[model samples]
Target: MKRIMLIVSYNGANYCGWQKQNNAISIEEVINTKLKELLKEDICVIGASRTDAGVHAKGNVAVFDTETTIPPEKIAYALNARLPQDIRIQESREVRADFHPRYDKNNKKYSYRILNTKINVPIYNEYTMHASNYLDIELMKNAAQYIVGEHDFKSFCAANTGVKTTVREVYSLEITKNNNDIITIEITGNGFLYNMVRIIVGTLIQVGTGKIKPEYVAEIIAAKDRSKAGPTAKAKGLTLEEIYY
Candidate 1:
């Protein structure tokens, strides 16, 4: 059997999450089923990231072992034809037989989007989190400086995460606003705890809205208390932009 890696993109509005569940549909379940039908073999994909429900992805990664004779490069074409329009395989190729999508070392980039306006824009409602108040991006950027390094991110992680450790390294955090009244918070990190990125964005939103001072971010990190941080941002605003192996 050869290991094939797939770069998957999905809307994520209709599925529960990346992982398979008993009662709900998921990206993993859908892909696994389609792959079984196409290859006529039992197939299971190991995903690199278990993105939460309502979270979109541009290039999420998954690896599956298959015995089919189809060329790895052409697998994407065949898979796309069978996949729903909301879910597509951007690319596919053979990978090292021993490579494991979840255990392999990798860094990820995620972005959170906000529609910052007095009125919500219907066209972008599904993909963006709507915020009525005007956001001060400069304040958010200033606050982000405290988060752009390795730290015990317990304050940003969600409760009952069940992870062994909350320590992770963040490479960078950038906040920018465009003319369309869209605010984007892009973060690159070696790893993240559950709801970590969304919590970070929520804390930054507090900073932007003057609810929390920019300097207070350091205090929150030092505290390492989940209750000390802001609320977790809506999942719909977050996207798994890329994973670098």
Candidate 2:
């Protein structure tokens, strides 16, 4: 058997998430079905990240074991012909037989976008979170700095996450606004807890809107209580940008 790794990208507007489910459609299920039909083998991919529903990805990774004679690099072209337009195989290649995507050491980067204007753009509605009030970008930037190092991120994670350790190291976090009044919060981390990125973005939004002081972010991190942080932002605005091995 040979292990093959695939770099997959998808617009997650219509699927439940990356993992296969019993009653719902998912990105992994769709790719697995297509691969089984192509290679005539019962194949299931192990994804690197389990992105939430309505969250998109540009460089998500997955690996599967197969015995096909097809060239590893050629699999991407053949797979794209069968995949939906929203989901495409960017690259595929063979790896060591023991390689696994999830257990490997890697850094993930994600971005959250917000449309901070009074009116919504119809074409971009599905991709961006809309906030009608004016946002102070400088204040948001100030709050993001506190999140740039190792800390206990339980305050930013969802309740009942069930993870044994909540401490995570964030390499960097940045907030920037575009000319069209779109604000983007980009973060790179060694790992993240459930809903951690969304909660961090929401807390920064609260700082920008004067609901919370910029200096209060450190206190929230120290509290390690989920209730001390702001609400979880909507999932549609978040995207998995890249993964570094």
Candidate 3:
């Protein structure tokens, strides 16, 4: 048996999440089903991350064991023909049998998009979060600095995440305004907890809207309480930008 690593990109608007679920459709389930049909074997894939519902990915990774005679690089093209339009296999390669996508990851980057306009753009409605009011971009930039270093991100994680340690290193947190109304927050980190990126976005939005001060970010992190943080931003605005191994 040979182990193959697959890098996948999917629009997560129509699926429950990345993992296979019994009651609901998922990206993983769809890919696994197609793989089983194409390869004529029962194959279970393990994903690198369990992205939330409505969250998209550009470079999500997964690995599976297969005994097929097909070449490793050809698996992506073969699988794409059978996969849905929203989900596509970006790249495939054979790796050591011991390679695991999840346990061996180095870092991940995520981005949250905000459409800060009075009227929502129809074209971007499915991908970007609409914020009607003007946001203080300077405040958001200032607030991003507090999360740049390692810290216990308990306040930014969802309740009952089951993570014993919330400490994570934020390599960079950048907020940039593309136009008058489009703002993007790009964050690179060692790892993240459940809903951590969305919660961080929400908190920064609060800072942008004057609901919270930029310095309050330190307070929130120090509090280590979820209630002290802002609400969870919509999952549609979040994307798995890339993963480094």
Cα displacement (Å) at residue 147, model 3 = 0.6
lDDT of 3 by residue, 124-211 (tens): 8777999998899899999999989999999999998887689999999999888557899999999999999999999999999999
Worst lDDT run of 10 residues, candidate 3, spans 174-183
Cα lDDT listed for each candidate: 0.94, 0.93, 0.93
How many clashing residue pairs appear in each of the predictions shown? Answer: 0, 0, 0
Q: Model 3 has how many clashing residue pairs?
A: 0
Clashing pairs in 1: none
Instruction: Point out the worst 10-residue segment of candidate 1 by lDDT.
Output: 125-134
Q: Please name the candidate that would achieve the greatest lDDT relative to the true structure.
A: 1
lDDT of 1: 0.94
Error of 2 at 199 (Å): 0.5
Q: Against the hidden reference, what TM-scores do the models get? A: 0.99, 0.98, 0.98
Residue pairs in collision within model 3:
none
